[model samples]
Target: MTVPPPPWRRAPSPRKRAEKPLLSPELVVRTALDILAAEGIRAVSMRRVAQQLETGPASLYAYVSNKEELDELMLDAVLGEIPCPEPDPEHWDEQVKEQVRRQVRAMMTYPGIAKVAWNTPIPVTPNALRQGEAMLAFLRAGGLDRKQAAFAGDALSMYAKAFAYEASGWTFGEYDPAHMAERERRMADYVQSLPAGAFPNLARIGQFFNAGTSADRMEFALETFVAGLRAVVRA
Candidate 1:
Protein backbone atom coordinates (compact mmCIF):
# COMPACT_ATOMS: atom_id res chain seq x y z
CA MET A 1 0.00 0.00 0.00
CA THR A 2 1.12 3.58 -0.68
CA VAL A 3 2.30 5.57 2.36
CA PRO A 4 -0.24 8.16 3.56
CA PRO A 5 0.71 11.68 4.72
CA PRO A 6 1.20 12.01 8.49
CA PRO A 7 -1.82 13.37 10.45
CA TRP A 8 0.42 16.12 11.88
CA ARG A 9 0.93 17.50 8.36
CA ARG A 10 -2.80 17.73 7.61
CA ALA A 11 -3.21 21.43 8.50
CA PRO A 12 -1.82 24.16 10.69
CA SER A 13 -3.35 24.71 14.15
CA PRO A 14 -5.73 27.70 14.47
CA ARG A 15 -3.36 29.16 17.05
CA LYS A 16 -0.37 28.90 14.66
CA ARG A 17 -2.18 30.76 11.85
CA ALA A 18 -1.15 34.38 11.46
CA GLU A 19 -3.58 36.73 13.19
CA LYS A 20 -4.97 39.62 11.18
CA PRO A 21 -4.85 42.95 12.94
CA LEU A 22 -8.31 44.23 13.76
CA LEU A 23 -9.62 46.52 11.02
CA SER A 24 -10.78 49.64 12.80
CA PRO A 25 -14.06 51.39 12.02
CA GLU A 26 -12.25 54.70 11.59
CA LEU A 27 -9.82 53.26 9.05
CA VAL A 28 -12.67 51.69 7.09
CA VAL A 29 -14.65 54.96 7.16
CA ARG A 30 -11.67 57.00 6.01
CA THR A 31 -10.96 54.62 3.14
CA ALA A 32 -14.61 54.71 2.10
CA LEU A 33 -14.56 58.50 2.11
CA ASP A 34 -11.39 58.50 -0.01
CA ILE A 35 -13.05 56.18 -2.50
CA LEU A 36 -16.15 58.40 -2.51
CA ALA A 37 -14.12 61.55 -3.12
CA ALA A 38 -12.19 59.97 -6.03
CA GLU A 39 -15.09 58.07 -7.57
CA GLY A 40 -18.70 59.17 -7.01
CA ILE A 41 -20.90 57.73 -4.25
CA ARG A 42 -22.12 54.88 -6.47
CA ALA A 43 -18.58 53.55 -6.67
CA VAL A 44 -18.38 52.93 -2.95
CA SER A 45 -19.32 49.40 -1.86
CA MET A 46 -18.18 47.02 0.86
CA ARG A 47 -16.57 44.73 -1.68
CA ARG A 48 -14.89 47.60 -3.52
CA VAL A 49 -13.69 49.08 -0.22
CA ALA A 50 -12.37 45.69 0.81
CA GLN A 51 -10.57 45.42 -2.52
CA GLN A 52 -8.94 48.78 -1.85
CA LEU A 53 -7.91 47.59 1.62
CA GLU A 54 -6.58 44.33 0.17
CA THR A 55 -8.91 42.24 2.30
CA GLY A 56 -12.08 40.18 1.97
CA PRO A 57 -15.54 41.73 2.37
CA ALA A 58 -15.89 39.88 5.64
CA SER A 59 -13.10 41.97 7.06
CA LEU A 60 -15.12 45.13 6.39
CA TYR A 61 -18.09 43.54 8.16
CA ALA A 62 -16.01 43.42 11.31
CA TYR A 63 -16.09 47.24 11.23
CA VAL A 64 -19.07 48.36 9.14
CA SER A 65 -22.25 46.33 9.24
CA ASN A 66 -23.35 47.36 5.72
CA LYS A 67 -23.10 50.01 3.02
CA GLU A 68 -25.52 52.29 4.88
CA GLU A 69 -23.33 52.32 7.97
CA LEU A 70 -20.30 52.95 5.80
CA ASP A 71 -22.06 55.88 4.10
CA GLU A 72 -23.11 57.41 7.43
CA LEU A 73 -19.55 57.06 8.69
CA MET A 74 -18.16 58.63 5.53
CA LEU A 75 -20.57 61.56 5.77
CA ASP A 76 -19.58 62.12 9.39
CA ALA A 77 -15.90 62.00 8.41
CA VAL A 78 -16.43 64.77 5.83
CA LEU A 79 -18.46 66.88 8.26
CA GLY A 80 -15.51 66.70 10.62
CA GLU A 81 -13.53 68.90 8.22
CA ILE A 82 -15.55 72.02 9.08
CA PRO A 83 -14.17 73.81 12.12
CA CYS A 84 -16.56 75.11 14.77
CA PRO A 85 -16.28 78.80 15.56
CA GLU A 86 -16.48 80.59 18.90
CA PRO A 87 -19.81 82.37 19.20
CA ASP A 88 -19.55 86.16 19.02
CA PRO A 89 -22.79 88.11 19.35
CA GLU A 90 -21.24 91.19 17.69
CA HIS A 91 -20.61 89.24 14.49
CA TRP A 92 -23.21 86.50 14.69
CA ASP A 93 -24.54 87.12 11.18
CA GLU A 94 -21.12 87.09 9.60
CA GLN A 95 -20.13 84.04 11.60
CA VAL A 96 -23.26 82.15 10.58
CA LYS A 97 -22.73 82.98 6.92
CA GLU A 98 -19.07 82.01 7.09
CA GLN A 99 -19.90 78.73 8.79
CA VAL A 100 -22.58 77.91 6.22
CA ARG A 101 -20.15 78.75 3.41
CA ARG A 102 -17.57 76.45 4.94
CA GLN A 103 -20.11 73.65 5.13
CA VAL A 104 -21.02 74.12 1.48
CA ARG A 105 -17.37 74.22 0.42
CA ALA A 106 -16.64 71.00 2.29
CA MET A 107 -19.57 69.27 0.60
CA MET A 108 -18.49 70.54 -2.80
CA THR A 109 -15.00 69.17 -2.27
CA TYR A 110 -16.35 65.64 -2.01
CA PRO A 111 -18.54 65.89 -5.18
CA GLY A 112 -21.48 63.59 -4.36
CA ILE A 113 -21.52 63.67 -0.57
CA ALA A 114 -24.01 66.53 -0.28
CA LYS A 115 -26.72 64.58 -2.10
CA VAL A 116 -26.27 61.72 0.31
CA ALA A 117 -25.95 63.95 3.37
CA TRP A 118 -29.42 65.49 3.49
CA ASN A 119 -30.98 62.08 2.94
CA THR A 120 -29.24 60.69 5.97
CA PRO A 121 -31.01 61.57 9.22
CA ILE A 122 -29.50 64.35 11.26
CA PRO A 123 -26.17 62.63 11.82
CA VAL A 124 -25.40 61.45 15.34
CA THR A 125 -21.65 61.84 14.89
CA PRO A 126 -19.79 64.11 17.30
CA ASN A 127 -18.59 66.37 14.48
CA ALA A 128 -22.11 66.84 13.14
CA LEU A 129 -23.46 67.45 16.63
CA ARG A 130 -20.70 70.00 17.21
CA GLN A 131 -21.72 71.86 14.05
CA GLY A 132 -25.29 72.00 15.33
CA GLU A 133 -24.14 73.23 18.71
CA ALA A 134 -22.07 75.96 17.13
CA MET A 135 -24.93 77.12 14.94
CA LEU A 136 -27.34 77.11 17.83
CA ALA A 137 -24.97 79.17 19.92
CA PHE A 138 -24.57 81.71 17.16
CA LEU A 139 -28.31 82.03 16.66
CA ARG A 140 -29.02 82.33 20.37
CA ALA A 141 -26.36 85.02 20.63
CA GLY A 142 -28.24 86.90 17.90
CA GLY A 143 -31.13 87.01 20.45
CA LEU A 144 -33.16 84.07 19.20
CA ASP A 145 -34.95 82.00 21.84
CA ARG A 146 -34.10 78.35 22.22
CA LYS A 147 -36.87 77.13 19.91
CA GLN A 148 -36.15 79.84 17.35
CA ALA A 149 -32.44 79.11 17.42
CA ALA A 150 -33.02 75.41 16.88
CA PHE A 151 -35.46 75.93 14.01
CA ALA A 152 -33.31 78.58 12.35
CA GLY A 153 -30.25 76.41 12.46
CA ASP A 154 -32.15 73.55 10.86
CA ALA A 155 -33.52 75.79 8.13
CA LEU A 156 -30.17 77.33 7.30
CA SER A 157 -28.40 73.99 7.16
CA MET A 158 -31.16 72.53 4.97
CA TYR A 159 -30.80 75.42 2.55
CA ALA A 160 -27.02 75.11 2.40
CA LYS A 161 -27.20 71.36 1.83
CA ALA A 162 -29.87 71.69 -0.87
CA PHE A 163 -27.90 74.33 -2.75
CA ALA A 164 -24.68 72.35 -2.57
CA TYR A 165 -26.39 69.18 -3.73
CA GLU A 166 -27.95 70.95 -6.70
CA ALA A 167 -24.67 72.55 -7.65
CA SER A 168 -22.83 69.23 -7.45
CA GLY A 169 -24.95 67.82 -10.30
CA TRP A 170 -23.16 70.16 -12.67
CA THR A 171 -19.80 68.66 -13.63
CA PHE A 172 -16.59 70.72 -13.74
CA GLY A 173 -16.37 70.31 -17.53
CA GLU A 174 -19.76 72.01 -17.86
CA TYR A 175 -18.35 75.15 -16.24
CA ASP A 176 -15.44 75.75 -18.63
CA PRO A 177 -15.38 79.39 -19.77
CA ALA A 178 -16.05 78.57 -23.39
CA HIS A 179 -18.75 76.05 -22.50
CA MET A 180 -20.48 78.50 -20.14
CA ALA A 181 -20.25 81.27 -22.70
CA GLU A 182 -21.93 79.08 -25.31
CA ARG A 183 -24.55 78.06 -22.77
CA GLU A 184 -25.22 81.70 -21.89
CA ARG A 185 -25.53 82.63 -25.55
CA ARG A 186 -27.98 79.80 -26.12
CA MET A 187 -30.01 80.69 -23.01
CA ALA A 188 -30.19 84.35 -23.92
CA ASP A 189 -31.23 83.55 -27.49
CA TYR A 190 -33.95 81.20 -26.25
CA VAL A 191 -35.31 83.74 -23.77
CA GLN A 192 -35.21 86.56 -26.35
CA SER A 193 -37.08 84.38 -28.83
CA LEU A 194 -40.02 84.08 -26.38
CA PRO A 195 -42.94 86.46 -26.94
CA ALA A 196 -41.85 89.90 -25.65
CA GLY A 197 -44.93 90.36 -23.44
CA ALA A 198 -44.84 86.78 -22.09
CA PHE A 199 -41.33 86.88 -20.60
CA PRO A 200 -40.41 90.55 -20.29
CA ASN A 201 -38.33 90.13 -17.12
CA LEU A 202 -36.24 87.35 -18.62
CA ALA A 203 -35.78 89.14 -21.94
CA ARG A 204 -34.89 92.47 -20.39
CA ILE A 205 -32.39 90.94 -18.00
CA GLY A 206 -30.87 88.50 -20.44
CA GLN A 207 -27.45 90.13 -20.27
CA PHE A 208 -27.67 90.51 -16.49
CA PHE A 209 -28.53 86.84 -16.23
CA ASN A 210 -25.08 85.97 -17.54
CA ALA A 211 -23.25 89.02 -16.19
CA GLY A 212 -22.11 87.66 -12.81
CA THR A 213 -19.60 84.90 -12.08
CA SER A 214 -20.53 81.81 -10.05
CA ALA A 215 -18.87 83.35 -7.00
CA ASP A 216 -21.01 86.46 -7.41
CA ARG A 217 -24.15 84.34 -7.59
CA MET A 218 -23.23 82.45 -4.45
CA GLU A 219 -22.45 85.63 -2.53
CA PHE A 220 -25.64 87.34 -3.69
CA ALA A 221 -27.72 84.36 -2.62
CA LEU A 222 -26.04 84.19 0.76
CA GLU A 223 -26.50 87.89 1.34
CA THR A 224 -30.17 87.76 0.38
CA PHE A 225 -30.85 84.81 2.65
CA VAL A 226 -28.98 86.35 5.57
CA ALA A 227 -30.82 89.60 5.09
CA GLY A 228 -34.11 87.74 5.19
CA LEU A 229 -33.06 85.87 8.31
CA ARG A 230 -32.14 89.14 10.01
CA ALA A 231 -35.55 90.56 9.18
CA VAL A 232 -37.37 87.48 10.46
CA VAL A 233 -35.42 87.26 13.68
CA ARG A 234 -35.74 90.96 14.40
CA ALA A 235 -39.45 91.01 13.67
Candidate 2:
Protein backbone atom coordinates (compact mmCIF):
# COMPACT_ATOMS: atom_id res chain seq x y z
CA MET A 1 0.00 0.00 0.00
CA THR A 2 2.94 2.29 0.57
CA VAL A 3 4.20 1.67 -3.04
CA PRO A 4 3.59 5.37 -3.55
CA PRO A 5 1.25 7.05 -5.94
CA PRO A 6 2.84 9.02 -8.76
CA PRO A 7 4.32 12.31 -7.55
CA TRP A 8 1.51 14.26 -9.28
CA ARG A 9 -1.15 11.87 -7.96
CA ARG A 10 0.04 12.07 -4.37
CA ALA A 11 -1.71 14.66 -2.32
CA PRO A 12 0.76 17.48 -1.86
CA SER A 13 2.61 16.36 1.27
CA PRO A 14 0.70 18.86 3.38
CA ARG A 15 2.91 21.72 2.29
CA LYS A 16 5.35 22.44 5.06
CA ARG A 17 4.91 26.01 6.18
CA ALA A 18 8.11 27.89 6.57
CA GLU A 19 8.84 28.67 10.18
CA LYS A 20 8.17 32.32 10.86
CA PRO A 21 10.99 34.25 12.42
CA LEU A 22 10.39 35.27 16.01
CA LEU A 23 8.64 38.54 16.55
CA SER A 24 10.13 41.25 18.76
CA PRO A 25 9.49 44.95 19.31
CA GLU A 26 12.71 45.86 17.58
CA LEU A 27 11.89 43.59 14.65
CA VAL A 28 8.43 45.07 14.30
CA VAL A 29 9.72 48.64 14.34
CA ARG A 30 12.52 47.81 11.97
CA THR A 31 10.12 46.15 9.56
CA ALA A 32 7.85 49.17 9.57
CA LEU A 33 10.75 51.56 8.97
CA ASP A 34 12.05 49.38 6.13
CA ILE A 35 8.65 49.53 4.49
CA LEU A 36 8.57 53.28 4.92
CA ALA A 37 12.00 53.65 3.36
CA ALA A 38 11.30 51.35 0.43
CA GLU A 39 7.76 52.33 -0.39
CA GLY A 40 6.97 55.48 1.57
CA ILE A 41 4.64 55.86 4.58
CA ARG A 42 1.47 55.13 2.68
CA ALA A 43 2.67 51.61 1.90
CA VAL A 44 3.42 50.82 5.54
CA SER A 45 0.60 49.15 7.48
CA MET A 46 0.13 46.43 10.06
CA ARG A 47 -0.82 44.02 7.33
CA ARG A 48 2.05 45.04 5.12
CA VAL A 49 4.59 44.85 7.90
CA ALA A 50 3.26 41.54 9.07
CA GLN A 51 3.42 40.21 5.54
CA GLN A 52 7.02 41.28 5.29
CA LEU A 53 7.71 39.50 8.54
CA GLU A 54 5.88 36.36 7.35
CA THR A 55 2.95 36.64 9.74
CA GLY A 56 -0.55 38.04 10.03
CA PRO A 57 -1.62 41.54 10.98
CA ALA A 58 -3.00 40.22 14.25
CA SER A 59 0.48 39.07 15.21
CA LEU A 60 1.80 42.63 15.18
CA TYR A 61 -0.56 43.68 17.99
CA ALA A 62 1.59 41.82 20.52
CA TYR A 63 4.37 44.24 19.64
CA VAL A 64 2.42 47.36 18.63
CA SER A 65 -1.06 48.31 19.80
CA ASN A 66 -2.03 49.95 16.53
CA LYS A 67 -0.87 52.03 13.58
CA GLU A 68 -0.62 55.17 15.66
CA GLU A 69 1.50 53.35 18.19
CA LEU A 70 3.61 51.99 15.36
CA ASP A 71 4.13 55.52 14.10
CA GLU A 72 5.23 56.66 17.54
CA LEU A 73 7.64 53.76 17.73
CA MET A 74 9.03 54.63 14.34
CA LEU A 75 9.48 58.27 15.30
CA ASP A 76 11.16 57.25 18.51
CA ALA A 77 13.53 55.02 16.58
CA VAL A 78 14.44 57.95 14.34
CA LEU A 79 14.93 60.18 17.36
CA GLY A 80 17.21 57.58 18.87
CA GLU A 81 19.55 58.03 15.92
CA ILE A 82 20.04 61.74 16.62
CA PRO A 83 22.63 62.79 19.20
CA CYS A 84 21.61 64.93 22.15
CA PRO A 85 24.36 67.41 22.82
CA GLU A 86 25.20 68.81 26.24
CA PRO A 87 23.80 72.24 27.07
CA ASP A 88 26.27 75.08 26.58
CA PRO A 89 25.30 78.21 28.52
CA GLU A 90 27.50 80.42 26.39
CA HIS A 91 25.93 79.19 23.15
CA TRP A 92 22.64 77.70 24.28
CA ASP A 93 20.68 79.45 21.55
CA GLU A 94 22.97 78.07 18.86
CA GLN A 95 22.90 74.72 20.58
CA VAL A 96 19.11 74.72 20.55
CA LYS A 97 18.99 75.62 16.87
CA GLU A 98 21.56 72.91 16.14
CA GLN A 99 19.42 70.34 17.96
CA VAL A 100 16.38 71.32 15.91
CA ARG A 101 18.42 71.19 12.74
CA ARG A 102 19.54 67.68 13.59
CA GLN A 103 15.96 66.56 14.18
CA VAL A 104 14.76 68.00 10.88
CA ARG A 105 17.62 66.34 9.06
CA ALA A 106 16.94 62.98 10.66
CA MET A 107 13.18 63.06 10.02
CA MET A 108 13.81 64.07 6.42
CA THR A 109 15.85 60.89 5.92
CA TYR A 110 12.63 58.89 6.21
CA PRO A 111 10.44 61.48 4.49
CA GLY A 112 7.12 61.10 6.36
CA ILE A 113 8.55 60.43 9.81
CA ALA A 114 8.30 64.10 10.70
CA LYS A 115 4.57 64.00 10.02
CA VAL A 116 4.28 61.28 12.63
CA ALA A 117 6.13 63.41 15.17
CA TRP A 118 3.94 66.36 14.25
CA ASN A 119 0.78 64.38 14.95
CA THR A 120 1.99 63.08 18.29
CA PRO A 121 1.64 65.60 21.08
CA ILE A 122 3.66 65.03 24.21
CA PRO A 123 5.07 61.71 23.14
CA VAL A 124 6.12 59.69 26.18
CA THR A 125 8.49 57.39 24.28
CA PRO A 126 11.95 57.13 25.78
CA ASN A 127 13.84 58.89 23.00
CA ALA A 128 11.15 61.54 22.69
CA LEU A 129 11.40 62.20 26.42
CA ARG A 130 15.15 62.36 26.06
CA GLN A 131 14.82 64.94 23.28
CA GLY A 132 12.47 66.98 25.45
CA GLU A 133 14.90 66.83 28.33
CA ALA A 134 17.78 67.97 26.14
CA MET A 135 15.76 70.87 24.73
CA LEU A 136 14.73 71.92 28.21
CA ALA A 137 18.32 71.92 29.33
CA PHE A 138 19.22 74.16 26.40
CA LEU A 139 16.45 76.62 27.21
CA ARG A 140 17.34 76.61 30.92
CA ALA A 141 20.92 77.37 30.01
CA GLY A 142 19.60 80.42 28.14
CA GLY A 143 17.82 81.55 31.34
CA LEU A 144 14.20 80.50 30.75
CA ASP A 145 12.12 79.33 33.70
CA ARG A 146 10.62 75.84 33.49
CA LYS A 147 7.30 77.10 32.15
CA GLN A 148 8.95 79.31 29.57
CA ALA A 149 11.36 76.57 28.56
CA ALA A 150 8.49 74.14 28.12
CA PHE A 151 6.55 76.57 25.95
CA ALA A 152 9.61 77.51 23.89
CA GLY A 153 10.61 73.90 23.43
CA ASP A 154 7.13 72.97 22.26
CA ALA A 155 7.09 75.83 19.74
CA LEU A 156 10.52 74.95 18.44
CA SER A 157 9.51 71.33 18.02
CA MET A 158 6.41 72.29 16.08
CA TYR A 159 8.40 74.59 13.85
CA ALA A 160 11.04 71.95 13.18
CA LYS A 161 8.47 69.25 12.43
CA ALA A 162 6.55 71.53 10.09
CA PHE A 163 9.71 72.52 8.28
CA ALA A 164 10.87 68.93 8.06
CA TYR A 165 7.56 67.91 6.50
CA GLU A 166 7.89 70.67 3.94
CA ALA A 167 11.51 69.86 3.23
CA SER A 168 10.71 66.19 2.87
CA GLY A 169 8.12 66.94 0.23
CA TRP A 170 10.82 68.54 -1.88
CA THR A 171 13.76 66.41 -0.83
CA PHE A 172 12.03 63.13 -1.55
CA GLY A 173 10.75 64.19 -4.96
CA GLU A 174 7.13 63.99 -3.88
CA TYR A 175 6.53 66.86 -6.25
CA ASP A 176 8.18 66.72 -9.64
CA PRO A 177 10.45 69.68 -10.21
CA ALA A 178 9.24 70.27 -13.76
CA HIS A 179 5.63 70.33 -12.65
CA MET A 180 6.42 72.58 -9.69
CA ALA A 181 8.31 74.98 -11.94
CA GLU A 182 5.38 75.22 -14.33
CA ARG A 183 2.94 75.74 -11.50
CA GLU A 184 5.13 78.46 -10.03
CA ARG A 185 5.44 80.15 -13.40
CA ARG A 186 1.68 80.17 -13.85
CA MET A 187 1.22 81.43 -10.30
CA ALA A 188 3.70 84.23 -10.93
CA ASP A 189 1.93 85.20 -14.13
CA TYR A 190 -1.42 85.24 -12.35
CA VAL A 191 0.02 87.40 -9.62
CA GLN A 192 1.49 89.81 -12.16
CA SER A 193 -1.85 90.05 -13.93
CA LEU A 194 -3.62 91.24 -10.80
CA PRO A 195 -4.28 94.96 -10.45
CA ALA A 196 -1.43 96.59 -8.46
CA GLY A 197 -3.73 98.81 -6.45
CA ALA A 198 -6.11 95.97 -5.62
CA PHE A 199 -3.36 93.71 -4.29
CA PRO A 200 -0.43 95.99 -3.66
CA ASN A 201 1.30 93.92 -1.01
CA LEU A 202 0.92 90.68 -2.95
CA ALA A 203 2.32 92.35 -6.07
CA ARG A 204 5.29 93.73 -4.13
CA ILE A 205 6.30 90.42 -2.51
CA GLY A 206 5.26 88.15 -5.37
CA GLN A 207 8.67 88.33 -6.99
CA PHE A 208 10.29 86.93 -3.85
CA PHE A 209 7.80 84.09 -3.51
CA ASN A 210 10.28 81.34 -4.41
CA ALA A 211 13.43 83.31 -3.86
CA GLY A 212 15.14 81.29 -1.11
CA THR A 213 16.49 77.76 -0.79
CA SER A 214 14.97 75.67 1.99
CA ALA A 215 18.23 75.81 3.99
CA ASP A 216 18.21 79.59 3.68
CA ARG A 217 14.66 79.69 4.96
CA MET A 218 15.41 77.32 7.81
CA GLU A 219 18.40 79.40 8.82
CA PHE A 220 16.25 82.52 8.91
CA ALA A 221 13.52 80.77 10.88
CA LEU A 222 15.87 79.33 13.52
CA GLU A 223 17.76 82.60 13.92
CA THR A 224 14.50 84.52 14.29
CA PHE A 225 13.08 82.10 16.84
CA VAL A 226 16.24 81.96 18.93
CA ALA A 227 16.67 85.73 18.81
CA GLY A 228 13.08 86.18 19.95
CA LEU A 229 13.38 83.74 22.88
CA ARG A 230 14.73 86.38 25.26
CA ALA A 231 11.73 88.64 24.58
CA VAL A 232 9.42 85.71 25.23
CA VAL A 233 11.26 84.87 28.45
CA ARG A 234 10.87 88.47 29.67
CA ALA A 235 7.21 88.71 28.76
The deviation in Å at residue 79 for candidate 2 is 0.9
For model 1, which pairs clash?
A: none
C-alpha lDDT of residue 126 in model 1 = 81
- Show the colliding residue pairs in model 2: none
Task: Please identify model 2 stretches exceeding 4 Å from their true place.
Answer: 1-20, 171-179, 197-201, 204-212, 230-235
Candidate 1, residues 1-235: lDDT per residue as tens digits? 9987798786655677576555899889888888877877768899998988889999788788998888788888888999998999999989989998999999988877887788785788788899899999998888888988888888888977887886765644324667777988898888888876998766786544443465667788778877876887789
What TM-score would every model get versus the actual structure?
0.79, 0.83
Q: After superposition, how far is residue 233 of candidate 1 from its true place, in Å?
A: 4.3
State each model's C-alpha RMSD to the native.
7.4, 6.0
Error of 1 at 10 (Å): 33
Clashes of 2: 0
Worst 10 residues of 2 by lDDT: 205-214
Error at 152, model 1, angstroms: 1.7
Candidate with the greatest TM-score versus the true structure? 2
Q: What are the lDDT scores of the predictions, listed in order?
A: 0.81, 0.88
